[model samples]
Target: MAQTISVAGLRKNYGDVRAVDGVSFEVDQGEFFGILGPNGAGKTTTLEIIEGLREADEGTVAVLGLPPWPRNSRLLPRIGVQLQASSFFERLTAREQLQTFGSLYGVPAKKADAMIETVGLTDKADVRVEKLSGGQAQRLSIACALVHDPELVFLDEPTAALDPQARRNLWDLLREINTAGRTIVLTTHYMDEAEILCDRVAIMDRGKILRLGPPASLVRGLDAPTRVSVASGVLAEDEAKDLPGADEVSDDDVSLTISTRDPSAVVAALSARDALDGVQIRGATLEDVFLDLTGREYRA
Candidate 1:
């Protein structure tokens, strides 16, 4: 696939803080790319730079083969963006708001109504902005973003405050957009959302990317193997070590963490000694990879 967005050695700073430092990545045409990070990890800064909202101190960025900074006039018409938080005229109805945004993008009012329907907000078209629920408001924001029928869309925490069902609804909407050949670039703190929506993700922290790959590939890269937990009995850590392929044993609250690639072998060994009171094996997940890479330290 052709590259729709490219960043090379991107850098940005605010006073003494380097919000984004030498970040580089690419979003292919029609692909869903995600930036995953903790709060204040520069995900938003990096995204803003690409969206032409902020300037980069160093490096280059190309959105649709045009420079992203200084508000590329030609590129602006081809891209859509939904900000993290959106506000509207309190008295304006949903249809009126869409019309206003559509006018700004040179889209016809007729086109705006179509977009309203696209976002499933037609029933609320005449309702005032202040009367809409959080999810309804979010849908309106998305509709405004799509009013221009952009080839690429930037969604910043689109599901942040939505209920579970609302989030799932938005996910389906996004999938429909992607299926129509619109590439999506999103920044999200939700791990499950990234795992489900993103084709590939870059994990960022302290203004740097620690890892980047498909979610499944990154999980597999951990190479930690499946873990089997069993209630602690008379088994010592050393005794558990006797089990084949048991790399480490950790105990807490009468439970043991038996790390081994071969769960069957470990289970058979425990069964042979009649020590298997309770055992459960599970594969690693994206959360485990995040914890292992970033450590358990709380980042403020």
Candidate 2:
């Protein structure tokens, strides 16, 4: 497929700090691409540069064949944006707020009503924005962004601060949007959300991408071995060391960590000995891979 978004050698600096340094990537048309990182990792900075909100110090950025910066008014109407912090006239009804945003994009009032329905806010359409819950407000924001029938959407932390049910609802909504052939570019810190919603993800830190691929492939590429933990009383150091395929066994009085490529082999070996008790094998997840890659350092 043709590229929907492209960036090369993207760099941005904020005085002493290089907010985005030497970043490059491409997002294919109709693909759900995500930028995953902790706060202050430059995910937002990069998004803003590509959204035409901020100018980059160096690099090229193209969205739907148009330069994102310099305000491509013609192209702006074809794209939708849901900012991390979206605000509106608190007193205006949800439907009214959407109508106003739609007018900004030159969309008709009828289209705005349709958008409100599309986001499942029809029952609450007449409710004032201030009365809407956080999730309701977020859904309204998404509906407003889509009111113009944009081919591409940029959602920044769309599910942040939402309840679990609300997050799940938004995830389903995003999947529906993507299934309808729209390209989505989102930035989020939630690993589980990225793993579930994104087709491909770029893990970024300190203004640079550390890894980029499908979440499953990225997790599979991790070198960390699967770990099996047992209650400290279940096994002694020598007993754990003797388990098949076990490596780097470490135990205290309460628990043990046993690294092994073949968790099944260890399980089978333990099962044969009838020594299994409180054993738990866990496959490595994206969270584990992320911590392994980025370390536990504080990023302010």
The total of clashing pairs for model 1 equals 0
Provide the overall lDDT of each model, using Cα atoms, as 2-decimal numbers: 0.90, 0.90
Q: Model 1, stretches more than 4 Å misplaced?
A: 228-259, 266-281
Error of 2 at 84 (Å): 1.0
Tens digits of per-residue lDDT, candidate 2, 33-134, equal 999887788999999999999999999999999998898886889899999999897689999999999899888999899988889999999999999999
Error of 1 at 192 (Å): 0.9
Which residue pairs show collisions in model 2?
Answer: none
Local accuracy of candidate 1 as per-residue lDDT tens digits, 231-281: 887467789988887887888867887988888898889888777777778
Q: Report how far residue 298 has shifted in candidate 2, in Å.
A: 2.5
Worst 10 residues of 1 by lDDT: 229-238
Q: Pick the candidate with the highest TM-score.
A: 2
Q: TM-scores across all candidates?
A: 0.87, 0.91
Model 2 global lDDT (CA atoms, 0 to 1): 0.90
C-alpha lDDT (0 to 100) for residue 182 of candidate 1:
95
